[model samples]
Target: MIDFFLAHQRNPHFTGRSSILKDLKGALTEGGPAVLIGPDGMGKSAIAEEHGRVNVTEYDFRLWVRAWDATVLATDYAGLAEPFGIPHQEDSDLQDLASSIRTWLEENERWLLVFDDAPSPEVLEEYLPRPGSGGGGVIITSKSPGWDGDFAKIEVGPLDPSEAASFLLSLTGQEDAEASKKLAEALESLPLALELAGAYIGWTGVPISKYLDIYRKRLGEISGRTSGLPEALVAVADISTEQVRAVSQEGIDLLRLSAFLAAEDLPLDLLVKTSALLADSVEMGLMALDRRGLVRRDEEPLSVHPLIQALAYSRLDDGERKTWADETVRAIGGAFSTYLGDLSTWPECARLLPHALASSEKVEDLRMGSEPASLLLNQVGLYLHRRGDLAGARNVLERLVVLDERFYGRGHPEVATDLNNLGSVLRVLGDLRAAKGCFERALAIEEAQDAPDRLKIAIRANNLGTVLRSLGDLTGALAAFERALAIDREAYGPNHLKTAIRLNNRGEVLQEMGDLDGAKESYQLAFRVFEQFLGPGHHYTQRARENLDSLSQSESD
Candidate 1:
């Protein structure tokens, strides 16, 4: 049976986990409770079973329990007795049977308990200790993080890059190194992701890169819209969420809320407090998440990949998202208001606000007079900017500026900051006239505020200068550039890379205006700044040299 599993494990199809296997061996030999933690299909069960049989003679008895069944209301000792074939005396009660096993283990020097997927921390901590005597140990493989006792936790991260590379090669049966690199990135180097990709590759007999494109399109179907993944891997995460949701409405609520939180290892208290669900519900939901491979919990923190989170969040449609977001926000706002004195709790409040805004009905209502509003606007700006939605980006920043001016007062640096941000969007959209107005307005505000926020002011000044140059207003551009350079030279000293960039910007402007000598002088100064600040080999310095060469060649002609 071990050989059979090993054979299945080795198929080029077999994703390697050398690191996890090594840690498993170390924990088994070290004589302590050991944990093998990872998501499903990463082969935690196989490893645990292999570890159990590694040294048959090392233990007097070894027992594996099917603890995941929800119908079993009994403890591990009683629940495991039938599987272990420990004869139950007709006269003895369940408690007596449990005691007898505990006594037997205490008397025996060798034993092992393989509690595969222990249901909950309460179950493990309250009733699931190893019954065996000295020299024996318990090995648990769980997706959940709660562990009590002196256990060595071995978290199984994704397969190593080399292992992943080899796996991809085998899957596609391809020899190209470039294709392998591209495939690895496509899979996020996740074992399950790679496995899914491999299956898709194997099924289609397509090129690895071609398969990657298909995989992305297929998986991206749910990327931001739904939580359902390909059917093959959905069970891994779905079972976890479903089980936790079944345990209680609160558990279900917690699971739903956690879907919106990041798919990284999260702290236990974070789920407990941030979730609108009850405390016990949160624990069960966590356990369910682990069991299903939707999440993998470790001693330190609970984490989920962006892919998993994407799927989970997709589970909520527009309506569900709105309801969840509303409830999450109200709960978070109340938590923040009531728990203001406890700064530790404040972060949870902060974390949930964005989630609330994801489906928030009234953006202004949620964002008004709040830090969350600023963060939301920034995130919106980022989204728009990435999508080349310059008009949309400008609108968000402009709104942010107006809101800041109304709430934080007219002279607040936030208003100036938004103006600069709006200017940036306008420039990107090629509306240089509007962009210039935005920049000049911001620069005037900065000069008046003079709030000692020189770094920010310097950036705006430099940007405004660039915009002016872009608009063919070289004189105005030159003035703005001079002011920016003076400030940067004072604040960051002459050799700073930012100063170099500004200098480079001015040189480009001079070159555009046909001032060959001035351009050459500015380029040389910029080159010196780059060389001194960022080293001779830096990319920007190389460009500066290229520009100088081009100008020198032109002069020769």
Candidate 2:
């Protein structure tokens, strides 16, 4: 009798599903076949296993079968026969084995059977005991919702938000109401996600706030090595994705794009832009995904569950991921502004930032220099830099340099541009020597070109001068600044913004060299140019005026 019951692990921290438990007990007590139907991570299997655990002594015999474990449901009776202690006979057919099992069950009184993770109604119907024929009951859990034919059906969903919050609190022994609520909301109240969150929190002793931060930043890595909760969530997602793919390849492609975007309120327009499918075909694909619970589209913008998104991303191979990433960048670039001057488009830009950042990181991993990759790197790098994410900016700019070098080779103008951008980030990070080296390399590249870009050469010289000054090399700094000023004056004339910038650079260098009179003259000239061309309210004009004022104040003192 002990051998008949399979050992099932119970959730130690399970909480708050009294109503479902009552319904499950009612169906089982009546000796009727019952099916628990729901999406993955809803605790359907847990409920079934819990009932089996509690009722282990009531039944004369009990058996558990993983119905989908076998390749051919029709031919695989081994899972069914195993609990009866029946060994496989090479000569016996599946029918004979199934018959022997049925005979054994018929001889037993008050027996129970559970078919966990049944793939579909048709697949399991033949294996199930005939309705009202058995002395005991049968319980099955499935991802399909339409498995209720001639059986009591219980639909399991996410735990109530309060219940989910309570569950987290109980598991972690935390008194934080707000953090628990936030964590529950972030996990979308899924049982598996909650369990994983609790396990991670308990193991790491991280506060709820820090856990949420790590969860967001490392979502794709959630299933890397952890067992139990993460594995369960990923298994469910894999089955769901395979089901969707079996129905429509378009659906699978859509799932890939959704993984790179925000999990909630994902804009369908953006999704459609990424796909090459016709609009109607895209609609059909989304419908297929919706039907499988891989994505939901009841609202205006479609959304995928966070766990599902993470699973989808983790499943892709490198090549397929690069292809999808390229498509994602192209789609977003079509809708969002790549040029930094487009401030009016900022609302949309802000909305796309999370997705863009994620996609840009994927593009960087490919290390290819395609147009879409370049666009993603350029925009994301600039955005991160402007937003004061200096580390993120450096990461993106460093990749951009690699990609530019690969695409255009050394000494190309694009490579020089990439190097200059990286140099700027390095300077801000206070790696003065490294920044100087980057700037010098960029200047050499610019100068080596047959039809050298005079403006770029001037910009690189100015940047190099700034780094040299930071390194306390006053002579090299002044020389570089002078060259920049001369180039800017020749290229764009004295009144241009570039020329004004170069003049300001020279003024700073002169001041650093103790040439107060020369510094004052340079500052005054730069201030006049900036004020006339850029207006007094402009940042450049204001900075130039401040420099001249400092010189006068020092003289008066």
Candidate 3:
């Protein structure tokens, strides 16, 4: 049931935007003209095609027109008339052609006309049928938003985040909720970007995590030969960018800087730091960008859509990109605090995490070993680990370790810290051997110093003990725990959480070694300390209680 003189092919994996489709259908059913306006690559034409496909039976005659750059609307009628089997003469007078089209529409009981990719309202104004001239409706899709006179406007934005995520999962036949959501967010929930990503994944059999890596590395370059989305992301971006540049060069510059930062809630203060433009000029530049639909500006911060950010970054030359990327690193890095252990600062750190990761990548790419860059990597890596993104954590922390070792040598305190962090991830990942080696190397480096960090040594010993225990080296684990206990007792007192933790660890090794009475004594002491300092309901106290109970039951048996 497809009637097409010039209808664009529908998307096979088309998903979501039901409400917008409904609204377009409602307008069409009421016999009114509707315009779908949005930025390039937002699937405006696809929605129109889907609407036409679903409602093909409602119209007696259906016509599609490619109104983009159509200088003479009358001459284009021959192409429109071809589908309906209506005879047309190329040499006919323009008025006669118009009369013929009008007469056909009046005679037909119902008909649908879709003016796809209209360049402007003025261009389509001459071609639009008059009110009550036809029974069916007209639909138009355009990049330009100015569709004023007598057309019901539907602003086709990106799909909803949930819908976009579901579309990706369905397209790839994957059931990973986290990865789907992350992919959806990374692509900015744009339908074309999501489609391209899904196509790439399905074609290559790449996991969602690996696809995210490729997408982050080459967002603008990701494309496929999908039916409806013929143009690559970079090509669409180039078109929009050319339009923005035509309006203002400052807008282009603003977008380029935004490309190196996060896609959402970009701080104006951070932008001001990197930009040489005065506050007023920056505001005007943002206004120009906003007008072109390249960026969204709020009261405090500005944001560029994710796809726009990727496109903007892709447009930069190597030298100019390096300069802007460095500036972005400095701006975002300056704002981010390296001390992530402070619970009060976590919200701000989480807010900055995306930008921090972007800036850190730029820093790594340029091999610029500034303090801010180091701090950005360290904090973001730690934050990712805390957030339970183990793969992401491993990637950043591994890079941090390599960089630190290269810059400060293998024996540096920073290298040891990186090693300790990496070891923690390895332990959680169940690589006990690698984790043990990491802890050993960190402990060795720390102990070799004339004036070592006693606290660091104690923490490393505690980590090593746990890994050793997991490897079933009960004696070695017990020794490691005792060393940590001795250090913590001297450094933080016997009642401290660190000391209690070491005591509990030592008790676990003792039980494993079949010294049940010794384990019982150690657990009792640890439990009393935890209850006094952290309360009986604390996790540490409960663990000590369970360990003591287990040991007591074993002795009775």
Q: Which model scores highest in TM-score? A: 2
Residue ranges of candidate 1 with Cα displaced over 4 Å: 1-363, 383-399, 532-537
Could you give candidate 2's per-residue lDDT for residues 1-557 as a string of tens digits? 64333344455677888788889889987767788888767878778867776777777666666554232232234345655667754333445566677766665666777786777777665566666566777888888777655778898999999999999998787888899998888778888777656755664477988777766655555556433335545543554456567778878877888776655456567657555532535777887776545665654656666567767777788887777777787777666676666656654654565566566656766675667767767786776566455666787788778777776787788878888998998999899888998999999998898998887888898899889988899999999999989988998887777877888888888887789989988888889888988898999999998998888888898
Kindly provide the TM-score of model 3 when superposed on the true structure, using C-alpha atoms. 0.54
- lDDT score for residue 114 of model 2: 77
Clashes (N, CA, C under 3 Å) per candidate = 17, 0, 0
Off by more than 4 A, model 2? 1-247, 259-264, 277-281, 305-319, 535-539, 552-557
Candidate 2 residue 229 C-alpha distance from true site, Å: 11
Model 1 over residues 142-228: C-alpha lDDT tens digits? 777766557788886667777778887886677766777777765657676665455445544678777556555555543443334
Give the lDDT ranking, best first. Answer: 3, 2, 1
- TM-score order of candidates, best first? 2, 3, 1
Judged by whole-model lDDT over C-alpha atoms, candidate 1 comes out at 0.60
Relative to the unseen true structure, what is the C-alpha lDDT of residue 431 in candidate 3, on a scale of 0 to 100? 85
lDDT of each: 0.60, 0.72, 0.73
Model 3, position 119: C-alpha lDDT score? 77
Q: Candidate 1 or 2, higher lDDT?
A: 2
Question: What shift in Å separates residue 479 of candidate 3 from its native position after superposition?
Answer: 2.5
**lDDT per residue (tens digit) for residues 1-557 in model 3:** 32663324455677888999899988876777899999866878778878877877786666766565332233344345655556754333444555667667656656777786787888655567777776767888888877776789999988899999998987787888899999888778877667656755664477988877765655455454222332445543444456567767777777887877755567666557644532435666776666444664545546565567766766567777777766776777666756666666655655576677776676677665556566678877776666555656777788888767766888998889999999999998888899999999999999988899998999999999999999988788888999999999999887777888888888889888988888888898899999998888999999999997887688678
